[model samples]
Target: MVRPLAVDVDGTLTRPKPDRGVDPRVFEALRAYSEEAPVVVATGKAFPYPVALCEFVGLPIRVVAENGGVVCIEQGDGDDPYGGGRFGDGVVYNGDREAADAVARAYEAEGHALGWGAVDLVNRWRETEIAVARDQPLAPLERVAAAHGQEVVDTGYAYHVKSPDVDKDIGLETAADRLGYGPGDFLAVGDSENDAEMFGVAGESWAVANADDAALSAADFVTDAAYADGFLEALERATE
Candidate 1:
């Protein structure tokens, strides 16, 4: 059997920001891949987005949303999330929401035009830290987050200002625990700096063609293709 696989959503499964939805091949590949083992969509897209996608696409896969803040277990035929198909994973915070919010407010007050993620209740009603879309230098912002026991890291598409207490690796570990697998039992794949956290933790890691330098450096392998296509190629190699 293939080991449990954790794939990032934005850059790995889908294209970058301003682009939405998974390619049909990616969606179908996920479904086919799931038959081999647990295939989880781990992303920074809040939580509801994954739920809606799964419901809309009829995917039976589990999800790790909000950059691993929570894991929605796959439904076992009887457990439904929205009264019909499936529900999202319960909220699991990697960082303190209160602390994260405090840090976010601090940045926004300083006149940082933050673009809040509307799908996950990032600003108004979130369980962990809020994700703000920003494309700028992060050194200064990093200091701001550090001051409050929080951190702001770029996920390629945005600067996630969050609780230093939790990260994607932490969330992945949590999911592994739930699935009764060890770090060496899976392959982590992605295409950004935030995804680097999964490298050392998983048995193997792959960086898509478009992965940033840091992500590529941390990966065990680098795919020739980019985005969803790269993911499928790497997955093929891994299972071989």
Candidate 2:
């Protein structure tokens, strides 16, 4: 049996930003899962987001944040393991910093109207993808990249310009290895193009009903419900 579950945050376990929070019912489902098996909250969000979620849900599950840039296992010591010089057996790909910066600089050099929102540098098993959010349409970004023979993928939350090799899949695999688990030991779930990698890496992957077309297509299964409902469904399936 799979020993634990690794779940995405936005649009998987919870809604996206502005409304960035988990559904109460889904939180309850997570609580239920925690009693039976370890449930890891794996997300592209920064460390604080998952930390808040875990506190809100009152569960001490593990968290893999920043798209695997950071991983912290909840400890029974009532203190954060990541805070005390314990990297928690995770490897963060530091190479993304340079690659992500290059992409950002390229976008700026083209004079495309891009929002300089916080960029989350991701290194998923040596594959690099720079995640950025913008308030305007993405067509301009795409048009700019098309001229260079590159592509910009719309992940709902943001526009991502990646190496086409690195993605959530690599991140999940890295996380599994760090946690001493394997593909057969965890259930992966998400709702966007950024999540495609994670889905591909898991033995069984699930997409929320409201997930993007690409994500839904890539998933091994689709839940009948959306967001929190999807998480609850997956949790139930994992425990069973």
Using TM-score, give the best candidate's number.
1
Report the lDDT tens digits of candidate 1 across residue range 1-240. 687888888888886446765766777777677677777677777777776666666665466777667667664542354465343344455667677777777776777745643453445544666777676446666777899877777887778877665667877887777666886788899888777887768888999998999899999999999988899999899889
- Per residue, candidate 2 scores C-alpha lDDT tens digits across 100-179 of 54656677786754464444333232233455565755776666555554456676776766444555566566666665
For model 1, state the Cα shift of residue 110 in Å.
Answer: 1.8
Query: After superposing candidate 1, which stretches have Cα over 4 Å from the reference?
Result: 16-18, 75-90, 116-125, 136-140
C-alpha root-mean-square deviation, each candidate: 3.3, 4.7
Q: How many clashes (backbone N, Cα, C below 3 Å) per candidate?
A: 3, 3
What's model 1's TM-score? 0.85
Go through the candidates in order and give each one's C-alpha lDDT. 0.74, 0.66
TM-score of each: 0.85, 0.75
lDDT of 2: 0.66
